[model samples]
Target chain A: TQLLEQSPQFLSIQEGENLTVYCNSSSVFSSLQWYRQEPGEGPVLLVTVVTGGEVKKLKRLTFQFGDARKDSSLHITAAQPGDTGLYLCALGGNEKLTFGTGTRLTIIP
Target chain B: DVKVTQSSRYLVKRTGEKVFLECVQDMDHENMFWYRQDPGLGLRLIYFSYDVKMKEKGDIPEGYSVSREKKERFSLILESASTNQTSMYLCASWGQNNYGYTFGSGTRLTVV
Candidate 1:
Protein backbone atom coordinates (compact mmCIF):
# COMPACT_ATOMS: atom_id res chain seq x y z
CA THR A 1 0.00 0.00 0.00
CA GLN A 2 1.16 3.56 -0.67
CA LEU A 3 1.37 6.11 2.11
CA LEU A 4 1.30 9.88 2.14
CA GLU A 5 3.31 11.98 4.55
CA GLN A 6 2.75 15.62 5.36
CA SER A 7 5.29 17.86 7.04
CA PRO A 8 4.78 19.95 10.18
CA GLN A 9 1.74 18.11 11.50
CA PHE A 10 0.73 21.31 13.23
CA LEU A 11 1.25 24.93 12.22
CA SER A 12 0.53 28.30 13.76
CA ILE A 13 1.18 31.69 12.23
CA GLN A 14 0.09 35.27 12.76
CA GLU A 15 -2.55 36.61 10.46
CA GLY A 16 -1.21 38.25 7.29
CA GLU A 17 1.90 36.02 7.35
CA ASN A 18 2.67 33.67 4.51
CA LEU A 19 2.80 29.91 5.07
CA THR A 20 3.39 26.79 3.10
CA VAL A 21 2.65 23.12 3.91
CA TYR A 22 3.86 20.04 2.10
CA CYS A 23 2.60 16.56 1.20
CA ASN A 24 4.86 13.83 -0.07
CA SER A 25 4.97 10.18 -1.02
CA SER A 26 7.57 7.78 -2.35
CA SER A 27 5.17 6.42 -4.98
CA VAL A 28 4.46 8.34 -8.13
CA PHE A 29 0.87 9.52 -8.65
CA SER A 30 -1.23 10.52 -11.63
CA SER A 31 -3.18 13.09 -9.64
CA LEU A 32 -3.51 14.58 -6.18
CA GLN A 33 -6.09 16.72 -4.39
CA TRP A 34 -6.04 19.10 -1.43
CA TYR A 35 -8.87 19.69 1.03
CA ARG A 36 -9.57 21.96 3.98
CA GLN A 37 -11.72 20.89 6.93
CA GLU A 38 -13.04 23.09 9.68
CA PRO A 39 -14.36 22.28 13.12
CA GLY A 40 -17.63 20.34 13.08
CA GLU A 41 -17.50 20.06 9.30
CA GLY A 42 -16.27 17.62 6.71
CA PRO A 43 -13.36 18.39 4.43
CA VAL A 44 -14.02 20.59 1.42
CA LEU A 45 -12.06 20.27 -1.79
CA LEU A 46 -9.58 23.03 -2.49
CA VAL A 47 -7.74 22.06 -5.65
CA THR A 48 -6.79 19.09 -7.78
CA VAL A 49 -3.52 18.93 -9.67
CA VAL A 50 -3.07 16.22 -12.31
CA THR A 51 0.00 17.17 -14.28
CA GLY A 52 3.48 17.02 -12.90
CA GLY A 53 4.92 20.49 -12.35
CA GLU A 54 1.41 21.93 -12.69
CA VAL A 55 0.32 24.75 -10.40
CA LYS A 56 -3.12 26.16 -9.62
CA LYS A 57 -4.03 29.24 -7.65
CA LEU A 58 -7.25 30.07 -5.79
CA LYS A 59 -7.32 33.65 -4.65
CA ARG A 60 -4.53 33.88 -2.08
CA LEU A 61 -3.77 30.16 -2.01
CA THR A 62 -1.45 28.42 -4.42
CA PHE A 63 -1.12 24.67 -4.98
CA GLN A 64 1.58 22.87 -6.91
CA PHE A 65 2.15 19.29 -7.92
CA GLY A 66 5.77 18.22 -7.87
CA ASP A 67 7.65 17.68 -11.11
CA ALA A 68 8.15 14.04 -10.15
CA ARG A 69 4.53 13.62 -9.03
CA LYS A 70 5.76 12.35 -5.69
CA ASP A 71 5.13 15.55 -3.77
CA SER A 72 2.88 18.58 -3.58
CA SER A 73 2.73 21.86 -1.68
CA LEU A 74 0.14 24.47 -0.70
CA HIS A 75 1.13 28.08 -0.16
CA ILE A 76 -1.09 30.66 1.44
CA THR A 77 -0.33 34.36 1.04
CA ALA A 78 -1.64 36.88 3.59
CA ALA A 79 -3.15 34.11 5.62
CA GLN A 80 -6.19 34.99 7.68
CA PRO A 81 -7.92 33.41 10.63
CA GLY A 82 -10.43 31.95 8.21
CA ASP A 83 -7.61 30.02 6.61
CA THR A 84 -7.14 27.95 9.75
CA GLY A 85 -8.17 24.32 9.36
CA LEU A 86 -6.93 20.80 8.81
CA TYR A 87 -5.39 20.40 5.36
CA LEU A 88 -5.29 17.01 3.69
CA CYS A 89 -3.91 15.57 0.46
CA ALA A 90 -5.57 12.59 -1.17
CA LEU A 91 -4.79 10.12 -3.92
CA GLY A 92 -7.59 8.49 -5.84
CA GLY A 93 -7.63 4.74 -6.20
CA ASN A 94 -9.77 1.99 -7.73
CA GLU A 95 -12.96 2.93 -5.87
CA LYS A 96 -11.77 5.12 -3.04
CA LEU A 97 -9.38 7.88 -2.18
CA THR A 98 -6.53 7.52 0.27
CA PHE A 99 -5.89 10.50 2.51
CA GLY A 100 -2.88 11.84 4.33
CA THR A 101 -2.69 12.19 8.10
CA GLY A 102 -3.31 15.91 7.65
CA THR A 103 -1.78 19.25 8.72
CA ARG A 104 -3.62 21.36 11.27
CA LEU A 105 -3.16 25.07 10.66
CA THR A 106 -3.94 27.87 13.08
CA ILE A 107 -3.83 31.48 11.95
CA ILE A 108 -3.80 33.84 14.91
CA PRO A 109 -5.44 37.18 14.37
CA ASP B 1 -24.34 23.74 -5.82
CA VAL B 2 -24.25 20.02 -5.09
CA LYS B 3 -25.04 18.94 -1.56
CA VAL B 4 -24.55 15.88 0.62
CA THR B 5 -26.66 15.92 3.73
CA GLN B 6 -26.12 13.79 6.80
CA SER B 7 -29.16 13.08 9.00
CA SER B 8 -27.82 14.25 12.32
CA ARG B 9 -25.29 16.82 13.44
CA TYR B 10 -24.87 15.19 16.85
CA LEU B 11 -25.99 11.98 18.51
CA VAL B 12 -25.60 10.20 21.80
CA LYS B 13 -26.24 6.50 22.17
CA ARG B 14 -25.74 3.76 24.71
CA THR B 15 -23.32 0.93 24.24
CA GLY B 16 -24.77 -2.16 22.52
CA GLU B 17 -27.49 -0.07 20.94
CA LYS B 18 -27.93 -0.30 17.22
CA VAL B 19 -27.32 3.03 15.54
CA PHE B 20 -28.15 4.21 12.09
CA LEU B 21 -26.66 7.25 10.42
CA GLU B 22 -28.24 8.42 7.24
CA CYS B 23 -26.73 10.32 4.34
CA VAL B 24 -28.34 11.76 1.23
CA GLN B 25 -26.88 13.45 -1.79
CA ASP B 26 -28.71 15.77 -4.15
CA MET B 27 -26.35 15.60 -7.10
CA ASP B 28 -27.58 12.11 -8.16
CA HIS B 29 -24.11 10.71 -7.64
CA GLU B 30 -23.66 6.99 -8.13
CA ASN B 31 -20.96 6.66 -5.49
CA MET B 32 -21.57 7.34 -1.79
CA PHE B 33 -19.16 6.79 1.08
CA TRP B 34 -19.06 6.67 4.86
CA TYR B 35 -15.98 7.68 6.79
CA ARG B 36 -15.08 8.19 10.42
CA GLN B 37 -12.86 11.08 11.51
CA ASP B 38 -10.63 11.08 14.52
CA PRO B 39 -8.13 13.51 15.97
CA GLY B 40 -4.97 11.83 14.64
CA LEU B 41 -6.32 9.25 12.26
CA GLY B 42 -7.76 11.72 9.75
CA LEU B 43 -10.72 10.20 7.91
CA ARG B 44 -10.99 6.42 7.73
CA LEU B 45 -13.39 4.86 5.29
CA ILE B 46 -15.99 2.61 6.81
CA TYR B 47 -18.18 1.65 3.87
CA PHE B 48 -19.24 2.70 0.38
CA SER B 49 -21.79 1.97 -2.32
CA TYR B 50 -21.49 2.01 -6.07
CA ASP B 51 -25.22 1.96 -6.66
CA VAL B 52 -28.48 1.08 -4.96
CA LYS B 53 -28.18 -2.19 -3.00
CA MET B 54 -24.51 -2.42 -3.89
CA LYS B 55 -22.16 -2.19 -0.91
CA GLU B 56 -18.51 -2.74 -0.27
CA LYS B 57 -16.22 -2.77 2.72
CA GLY B 58 -13.68 -0.06 3.18
CA ASP B 59 -10.47 0.38 5.21
CA ILE B 60 -12.30 -0.02 8.52
CA PRO B 61 -15.56 -1.92 8.50
CA GLU B 62 -15.32 -4.25 11.45
CA GLY B 63 -18.34 -3.22 13.52
CA TYR B 64 -20.14 -1.18 10.88
CA SER B 65 -22.51 -1.97 8.02
CA VAL B 66 -24.04 0.11 5.28
CA SER B 67 -27.24 0.29 3.27
CA ARG B 68 -27.99 1.89 -0.08
CA GLU B 69 -31.63 1.21 -0.72
CA LYS B 70 -32.22 4.10 -3.09
CA LYS B 71 -30.04 5.89 -5.53
CA GLU B 72 -29.57 8.98 -3.41
CA ARG B 73 -29.41 7.73 0.19
CA PHE B 74 -26.73 5.72 1.90
CA SER B 75 -26.92 4.73 5.52
CA LEU B 76 -24.27 3.50 7.92
CA ILE B 77 -25.33 1.09 10.62
CA LEU B 78 -23.52 0.17 13.80
CA GLU B 79 -24.66 -3.24 14.90
CA SER B 80 -23.45 -2.69 18.42
CA ALA B 81 -22.18 0.66 19.48
CA SER B 82 -19.14 0.96 21.70
CA THR B 83 -17.11 3.71 23.27
CA ASN B 84 -14.31 3.16 20.78
CA GLN B 85 -16.81 3.66 17.98
CA THR B 86 -17.50 7.23 18.94
CA SER B 87 -16.28 9.55 16.22
CA MET B 88 -17.32 12.11 13.68
CA TYR B 89 -18.92 10.39 10.69
CA LEU B 90 -18.81 11.91 7.25
CA CYS B 91 -20.73 11.09 4.08
CA ALA B 92 -19.53 11.86 0.60
CA SER B 93 -20.62 11.54 -3.02
CA TRP B 94 -18.40 11.58 -6.08
CA GLY B 95 -18.77 12.11 -9.81
CA GLN B 96 -16.69 10.13 -12.25
CA ASN B 97 -13.51 11.67 -13.69
CA ASN B 98 -13.79 14.55 -11.20
CA TYR B 99 -11.92 13.76 -8.02
CA GLY B 100 -13.29 16.67 -6.06
CA TYR B 101 -15.87 14.92 -3.85
CA THR B 102 -18.85 16.56 -2.23
CA PHE B 103 -19.01 15.82 1.51
CA GLY B 104 -21.60 16.27 4.18
CA SER B 105 -21.07 18.42 7.26
CA GLY B 106 -20.68 15.25 9.36
CA THR B 107 -22.46 13.66 12.28
CA ARG B 108 -20.70 13.56 15.63
CA LEU B 109 -21.69 10.30 17.32
CA THR B 110 -20.82 9.56 20.91
CA VAL B 111 -21.34 6.11 22.41
CA VAL B 112 -21.43 5.92 26.13
Candidate 2:
Protein backbone atom coordinates (compact mmCIF):
# COMPACT_ATOMS: atom_id res chain seq x y z
CA THR A 1 0.00 0.00 0.00
CA GLN A 2 1.19 3.52 -0.73
CA LEU A 3 1.37 5.75 2.31
CA LEU A 4 1.80 9.49 2.56
CA GLU A 5 2.79 11.20 5.80
CA GLN A 6 2.26 14.86 6.55
CA SER A 7 4.20 16.88 9.10
CA PRO A 8 3.01 19.27 11.80
CA GLN A 9 -0.32 17.55 12.29
CA PHE A 10 -1.64 20.72 13.89
CA LEU A 11 -0.63 24.31 13.29
CA SER A 12 -1.64 27.65 14.79
CA ILE A 13 -0.45 31.00 13.59
CA GLN A 14 -1.41 34.62 13.63
CA GLU A 15 -2.90 36.24 10.56
CA GLY A 16 -0.31 37.44 8.05
CA GLU A 17 2.13 34.72 9.10
CA ASN A 18 3.55 32.31 6.55
CA LEU A 19 3.43 28.58 7.04
CA THR A 20 4.45 25.55 5.06
CA VAL A 21 3.29 21.96 5.45
CA TYR A 22 5.19 19.02 4.08
CA CYS A 23 4.01 15.69 2.74
CA ASN A 24 6.51 12.90 2.33
CA SER A 25 6.40 9.37 0.99
CA SER A 26 8.79 6.53 0.30
CA SER A 27 7.13 5.53 -2.93
CA VAL A 28 6.94 7.74 -6.00
CA PHE A 29 3.62 9.06 -7.20
CA SER A 30 2.39 9.95 -10.66
CA SER A 31 0.56 13.01 -9.40
CA LEU A 32 -0.17 14.79 -6.16
CA GLN A 33 -3.04 16.99 -5.05
CA TRP A 34 -3.82 19.37 -2.21
CA TYR A 35 -7.23 19.73 -0.60
CA ARG A 36 -8.72 22.03 2.01
CA GLN A 37 -11.61 20.92 4.18
CA GLU A 38 -13.86 23.06 6.30
CA PRO A 39 -15.60 21.82 9.37
CA GLY A 40 -18.52 19.49 8.68
CA GLU A 41 -17.84 19.56 4.92
CA GLY A 42 -15.97 17.43 2.45
CA PRO A 43 -12.60 18.53 1.20
CA VAL A 44 -12.23 20.90 -1.72
CA LEU A 45 -9.41 20.59 -4.21
CA LEU A 46 -6.80 23.32 -3.97
CA VAL A 47 -4.25 22.33 -6.61
CA THR A 48 -2.63 19.39 -8.38
CA VAL A 49 1.01 18.94 -9.30
CA VAL A 50 1.88 16.28 -11.86
CA THR A 51 5.48 16.92 -12.76
CA GLY A 52 8.48 16.56 -10.55
CA GLY A 53 9.74 19.89 -9.25
CA GLU A 54 6.56 21.54 -10.54
CA VAL A 55 4.99 24.40 -8.66
CA LYS A 56 1.47 25.76 -8.91
CA LYS A 57 0.05 28.84 -7.24
CA LEU A 58 -3.52 29.57 -6.38
CA LYS A 59 -3.96 33.02 -4.92
CA ARG A 60 -2.19 32.92 -1.54
CA LEU A 61 -1.41 29.19 -1.63
CA THR A 62 1.49 27.61 -3.45
CA PHE A 63 2.01 23.87 -3.98
CA GLN A 64 5.15 22.10 -5.10
CA PHE A 65 5.89 18.52 -6.10
CA GLY A 66 9.28 17.22 -5.12
CA ASP A 67 11.97 16.43 -7.64
CA ALA A 68 11.76 12.72 -6.80
CA ARG A 69 7.97 12.66 -6.99
CA LYS A 70 8.01 11.14 -3.53
CA ASP A 71 7.14 14.32 -1.60
CA SER A 72 5.25 17.58 -1.84
CA SER A 73 4.65 20.78 0.10
CA LEU A 74 2.03 23.46 0.50
CA HIS A 75 2.96 27.03 1.40
CA ILE A 76 0.53 29.66 2.51
CA THR A 77 1.53 33.31 2.36
CA ALA A 78 -0.12 35.87 4.62
CA ALA A 79 -2.50 33.40 6.12
CA GLN A 80 -5.98 34.57 6.98
CA PRO A 81 -8.75 33.36 9.23
CA GLY A 82 -10.38 31.75 6.25
CA ASP A 83 -7.34 29.53 5.85
CA THR A 84 -8.11 27.75 9.08
CA GLY A 85 -9.07 24.27 8.00
CA LEU A 86 -7.74 20.78 7.47
CA TYR A 87 -5.26 20.43 4.65
CA LEU A 88 -4.85 17.05 2.99
CA CYS A 89 -2.45 15.75 0.39
CA ALA A 90 -3.36 12.92 -1.93
CA LEU A 91 -1.35 10.85 -4.35
CA GLY A 92 -3.02 9.26 -7.31
CA GLY A 93 -2.37 6.71 -10.01
CA ASN A 94 -4.35 3.85 -11.58
CA GLU A 95 -7.58 5.58 -10.59
CA LYS A 96 -7.01 5.26 -6.84
CA LEU A 97 -6.05 8.02 -4.44
CA THR A 98 -4.07 7.60 -1.20
CA PHE A 99 -4.57 10.51 1.16
CA GLY A 100 -2.26 11.83 3.83
CA THR A 101 -3.11 12.08 7.52
CA GLY A 102 -3.90 15.82 7.07
CA THR A 103 -2.86 18.99 8.84
CA ARG A 104 -5.28 21.03 10.89
CA LEU A 105 -4.46 24.73 10.58
CA THR A 106 -5.81 27.59 12.60
CA ILE A 107 -5.04 31.19 11.69
CA ILE A 108 -5.73 33.51 14.59
CA PRO A 109 -6.63 37.15 14.26
CA ASP B 1 -19.50 21.88 -10.73
CA VAL B 2 -19.83 18.18 -9.94
CA LYS B 3 -22.17 17.29 -7.13
CA VAL B 4 -22.04 14.29 -4.85
CA THR B 5 -24.83 13.81 -2.33
CA GLN B 6 -25.00 11.61 0.71
CA SER B 7 -28.29 10.50 2.21
CA SER B 8 -27.56 11.51 5.80
CA ARG B 9 -25.23 14.05 7.35
CA TYR B 10 -25.35 12.55 10.83
CA LEU B 11 -26.39 9.12 12.05
CA VAL B 12 -26.51 7.39 15.41
CA LYS B 13 -26.96 3.67 15.77
CA ARG B 14 -26.77 1.17 18.56
CA THR B 15 -24.29 -1.64 18.68
CA GLY B 16 -25.13 -4.75 16.63
CA GLU B 17 -27.64 -2.82 14.52
CA LYS B 18 -27.37 -2.85 10.78
CA VAL B 19 -26.63 0.50 9.20
CA PHE B 20 -26.78 1.72 5.64
CA LEU B 21 -25.10 4.78 4.17
CA GLU B 22 -26.13 5.91 0.71
CA CYS B 23 -24.27 8.06 -1.79
CA VAL B 24 -25.35 9.46 -5.14
CA GLN B 25 -23.51 11.40 -7.80
CA ASP B 26 -25.12 13.64 -10.39
CA MET B 27 -22.17 13.85 -12.77
CA ASP B 28 -22.61 10.28 -14.02
CA HIS B 29 -19.15 9.33 -12.91
CA GLU B 30 -17.97 5.81 -13.65
CA ASN B 31 -16.08 5.36 -10.39
CA MET B 32 -17.42 5.76 -6.84
CA PHE B 33 -15.52 5.29 -3.61
CA TRP B 34 -16.33 4.90 0.10
CA TYR B 35 -13.90 6.04 2.77
CA ARG B 36 -13.78 6.39 6.52
CA GLN B 37 -11.91 9.21 8.24
CA ASP B 38 -10.56 8.93 11.76
CA PRO B 39 -8.71 11.42 13.92
CA GLY B 40 -5.14 10.36 13.06
CA LEU B 41 -5.62 7.68 10.42
CA GLY B 42 -6.71 9.97 7.59
CA LEU B 43 -9.20 8.78 5.00
CA ARG B 44 -9.05 5.06 4.47
CA LEU B 45 -10.75 3.55 1.48
CA ILE B 46 -13.38 1.02 2.46
CA TYR B 47 -14.61 0.03 -0.95
CA PHE B 48 -14.86 1.29 -4.52
CA SER B 49 -16.89 0.46 -7.59
CA TYR B 50 -15.75 0.97 -11.13
CA ASP B 51 -19.02 0.08 -12.79
CA VAL B 52 -22.51 -1.02 -11.98
CA LYS B 53 -22.50 -4.24 -9.93
CA MET B 54 -18.72 -4.36 -9.90
CA LYS B 55 -16.89 -3.70 -6.67
CA GLU B 56 -13.39 -3.85 -5.22
CA LYS B 57 -12.27 -3.94 -1.62
CA GLY B 58 -9.98 -1.10 -0.59
CA ASP B 59 -7.48 -0.86 2.22
CA ILE B 60 -9.95 -1.34 5.06
CA PRO B 61 -12.89 -3.46 3.94
CA GLU B 62 -13.03 -5.94 6.77
CA GLY B 63 -16.08 -4.58 8.58
CA TYR B 64 -17.93 -3.06 5.63
CA SER B 65 -19.81 -4.03 2.51
CA VAL B 66 -20.85 -2.01 -0.54
CA SER B 67 -23.53 -2.26 -3.18
CA ARG B 68 -23.68 -0.55 -6.57
CA GLU B 69 -26.85 -1.29 -8.43
CA LYS B 70 -26.79 1.71 -10.77
CA LYS B 71 -24.18 3.92 -12.27
CA GLU B 72 -24.90 6.94 -10.11
CA ARG B 73 -25.66 5.42 -6.74
CA PHE B 74 -23.52 3.44 -4.32
CA SER B 75 -24.33 2.25 -0.87
CA LEU B 76 -22.20 1.18 2.08
CA ILE B 77 -23.57 -1.22 4.60
CA LEU B 78 -22.43 -2.24 8.03
CA GLU B 79 -23.72 -5.66 8.87
CA SER B 80 -23.40 -4.97 12.59
CA ALA B 81 -22.43 -1.60 13.91
CA SER B 82 -19.67 -1.46 16.48
CA THR B 83 -18.12 1.29 18.52
CA ASN B 84 -14.93 0.93 16.53
CA GLN B 85 -16.85 1.72 13.35
CA THR B 86 -17.82 5.15 14.50
CA SER B 87 -16.22 7.66 12.18
CA MET B 88 -16.88 10.12 9.41
CA TYR B 89 -17.78 8.31 6.24
CA LEU B 90 -17.07 10.02 2.94
CA CYS B 91 -18.16 9.35 -0.62
CA ALA B 92 -16.37 10.40 -3.77
CA SER B 93 -16.71 9.97 -7.53
CA TRP B 94 -14.37 10.34 -10.47
CA GLY B 95 -15.02 10.62 -14.14
CA GLN B 96 -13.05 9.05 -17.01
CA ASN B 97 -10.68 11.97 -17.38
CA ASN B 98 -9.16 11.39 -13.92
CA TYR B 99 -9.29 15.13 -13.28
CA GLY B 100 -9.97 14.67 -9.57
CA TYR B 101 -12.35 13.05 -7.19
CA THR B 102 -15.33 15.13 -6.10
CA PHE B 103 -16.50 14.33 -2.57
CA GLY B 104 -19.79 14.50 -0.78
CA SER B 105 -20.35 16.34 2.50
CA GLY B 106 -19.81 13.08 4.47
CA THR B 107 -21.86 11.28 7.10
CA ARG B 108 -20.80 11.27 10.72
CA LEU B 109 -21.85 7.96 12.29
CA THR B 110 -21.81 7.23 15.97
CA VAL B 111 -22.22 3.71 17.25
CA VAL B 112 -23.09 3.50 20.89
Score candidate 2 by TM-score against the native: 0.98
By summed lDDT, the worst window of 10 consecutive residues in model 2 chain B runs over: B93-102
Off by over 4 Å in 1: none
For residue B12, give model 2's deviation from the true position in Å: 0.6
lDDT of 2 at B102: 93
Model 2 has an lDDT value of: 0.94
- Which docking class does model 1 fall in? medium
What would the per-residue lDDT of candidate 1 be over residues A6-70, giving only the tens digit for each residue?
98899999999999999998799988999999988899999989999999999999999999999
Clashes of 2: 0
Candidate 1 residue B21 C-alpha distance from true site, Å: 0.2
The top-ranked prediction according to DockQ is 2
Model 1, residue pairs in steric clash: none
| Candidate 1 fraction of reference contacts recovered | 0.71
Per-residue alpha-carbon lDDT of candidate 2 for residues A1-109, written as tens digits (9 for 90 to 100): 7879999999999999999999998799899989999999998888888999999999999899999999999999999999999999998864689999999999999
